[model samples]
Target: MDLFSLKGKRALVTGGTHGLGMAMAEGLAVAGAELIITGTTPTKMDDALSYYKRKGFKAYGYLFDVTNEKVAKENISKITKEIGEIHILVNNAGIIKRELAITMPVEDFRRVIEVDLVGPFIMSQLVAKQMIDRKEGKIINICSMMSELGRNSVSAYAAAKGGLKMLTQNLATEWAKYNIQVNGIGPGYFATSQTEPIRVDGHPFNEFIINRTPAARWGNPEDLAGAAVFLASKASDFVNGQVIYVDGGILATIGKPSNED
Candidate 1:
C-alpha cells in the first residue's frame, strides 16, 4: 500500500499564499492532494492561484481571516459546499510581534494571541466538525520553536505558540475517538524571503542561528515538506497529539561553546 499517498484528499491550508505554508501545500499537492489555499487578501489569493495554475497544478484560493470566527465559519462552509469535504486541514495562519514584555502594549499581546492561538482553535473546531461526522481527518497546526523555547523580544509569540502546543494535544485527545489526528509542526529558522536580510553572511542573528543549531545551518522551506506530507498522510494513522520539531536538531541539544572545536 502507498502509505504516503494523498490521492483523492482535499487539503485546506490557511495562510498558504507564500513562505513555508506554500511549501507544505506544494508537498501535499505533489503527493496528489487537491489544494485549497487561504489568504486574507484577494490579490494574494489570486496571485497564489495563478502561480499554481502556471505550474500545471489546479488549486483553489480563498480570502478569509482565520481569527474572525464568523468569517472563518462562513468561508469554511462555503468551501465545503463549493469544493468538498476537507480531509486535511493545515492551520498555518499566524503572526508575530517582536516586543519585549516590559514595554509591549497589552493590545499587541492580545493581537498576537488572537492570530496565533485563537485563530487555529476556530479553524480546527469548524473543520473538525466535518471530519468528526466522516469519522476521519488530519489537522496540522503550524507551531514554532517558541512553542517550547523562549527568546528575547517575542513574548507574545512564545506565549501563543506554547498555548497552541497544548491545544494540539487537547484536540488530539478529544478527537481521537472519532479517528481524527491533530498534530503540530515546530519549524526552526528557515532561509526564506522574509528572513533574507537577516540571513546574509556576518549578520549577527544569522551567525547566532548557525552556531546555536546543531546542524550549523538555516533550514530551507522545502525541508519541511517531508514532515508535512507524513503527518498529512495515512502513514501517521496512529500518530496523534505529537509535535514534530523540524528544527535541524536545535531542540535536541544544548549548544557548543563558541570556541569549541
Candidate 2:
C-alpha cells in the first residue's frame, strides 16, 4: 500500500542494457513493475534480459537506436503491439564524449545531441501520446550535473543535458493537465561504466570530486534508483517538471576544497 510501490505498473526504459540504465530497470523490476529495456547491442540486451530473468523479474528487451526517429517509432509500435500500454518511461539512455569545444568536431557534437537530447524528445513524444489516451503516465528523465553546471571540455554534453532539462519542463507543463507527471533526476559523478576510465586512472579528478562533494565520495548507480521509483509512483503524482539532484551535495558547494576541522 506504499505510495512508492510500482506493483502492477509497466515501465519502458531506453538504454537499459547497462550502466545506469540497467540499474534503473532492475530497481523498477524489484519494485514489481514489468520492465522493458531497449538498447543497440543484441548481446548486451540478451545478457541483461537473461540476468533479470534469472532473478525472476518480468523483463524484456528491444533492439533499437533511440537516436533514429524512424527506428524509435517502429520499435515503439512493435512494443505496443506486444505489450499493452507502458505506464512509466525512464529516459535513461545517454552518451557522453569529452572534448574541448574549439577542438571538438561538429559531427561529434551533433551525434551526442542526437542521442542525449533529440532521442529523449522523440521517445517522450511517442510515449506521451499513448499516455494521453490512457490519461495517466510517469516520465523520468536522467539528466546530469552538467545540466546545471559545466566543466572543462564536453560542451556538447553540457548543451544536450541542459536542453534536456528544459525539454522535461516543457513536457510537464504541457502534459500535466492530462494527469501525467514529467520530471527529471540529475545525477552527479557516479561510479559506472561511464566513469571507469577516471576511476581506473586514479587521477586527481577523483580526489577533487570527493573534496568538492560534501558527501566526500562519488555516488553509486543505486542512489538514483529510488528517486526514479518515487517519480514513477503515486508518491510523486503531484510532482511535475522538477529536476531532483542526487549529487551527494556536489551542487551545494563552491570555492576550494576544505579538510575537516
Candidate 3:
C-alpha cells in the first residue's frame, strides 16, 4: 500500500481561499484527495476554484462563515451531500488582531476568539459526527507559535490559539477510539505576500526571524505541505493529539546573542 497516498478521500479545508490554507489544500490534492475549500466571499471562492482548475486540479469552493454554527452545519451538510464524505478536515479559518491587550476593544477580542477558537470547535464537532458514523477521519487545526509562546500586540490571538491547542488534544482523546485523529500544525513566520514588506533583506523583523530561527530564513508556504499531508492522511493513523511545530527550530532554543558570534 502507498501509505501516504490519500486516494479516494475527500478533504474539506476551511478558509482555504489563499495563503497557507490553500497551500495545504493543494498538498492534499496532489496526494490524490478531492478538495473542497471554504471562503467567506464568493469572489475569493470563485478565484481560488479557478486557480486550482487552471492548474488541472479538481477543486470546489464554498462561501460560508465558519464562525456561525448554523452556517457551518448547513454548509457542511451541503458539502457532504453534494461532494462526498469528507474524510479529512483542515480547520484553517482564523483571524488575528494585532492590538495591545489594554487598548484592544472587548468586541474585537471577542470576535477573534469567536472566529479562531469557537469556529474550529463548531467545525470539528459537525465534521466529527459524520466521521464517527463512518468510524474514520482526520482533523488538522491550524495553530500557531502563539499556541505556545506569546508576542506583543496579539493577546487575543494568543489566547484563542492556546485554547485551540487544548481543544485539539481533547478532541483527539475523545475521538481516538473511533479511529479519528485530531492534531494541530503550529506554523512559524512564513514569507507570504502579506509579509513581503517585512521580509526585506534588512528589515528589523526579518533580521530577528532569520537570527531567531535555526533555519535562518522565513518559511515558504510550501514548507507546510508535507506536515499537512501527513496529518491528513492514513500515514498519521496512530498519531493523535499532537501539535507539530513547523517553526524552523525556533522553539528549540532561546537564541544566540547578537554579540556572541
| lDDT at 202, model 1 | 95
**lDDT tens per residue, model 3, 43-85:** 8888899998988888988898999888888998999888878
How many residue pairs collide in each prediction?
0, 0, 0
Q: lDDT of each model, Cα atoms only?
A: 0.94, 0.90, 0.93
| Candidate 1 Cα errors over 4 Å, as ranges | none
Clashes in candidate 2: how many?
0
TM-score of each: 0.98, 0.96, 0.98
Clash pairs of candidate 3? none
Residues 1-261 of candidate 1 have per-residue lDDT tens digits of 389999999999999999999999988988989999999878878888888788777699889889999999999999999999999999999889888899999999999999999999999999999999999999999999999999999999999999999999999999999999999999999999889999999999998899999999999999999999999999999999999999999999898988875
Highest lDDT against the true fold, candidate: 1
lDDT of 1 at 64: 80
Candidate 2 local lDDT, 25-105, one digit each (tens): 888888889999998989999999999899899998899888888889988899999987889999988988889998999
Candidate 2 wrongly placed segments (more than 4 Å): 200-202, 255-261
Using lDDT as the measure, name the better of candidate 1 and candidate 3.
1
Lowest summed lDDT across 10 adjacent residues in model 3 is found at 252-261
**lDDT ranking, high to low:** 1, 3, 2
Cα deviation of 193, candidate 3, in Å: 1.4
- The global Cα lDDT (0 to 1) of model 3 is 0.93
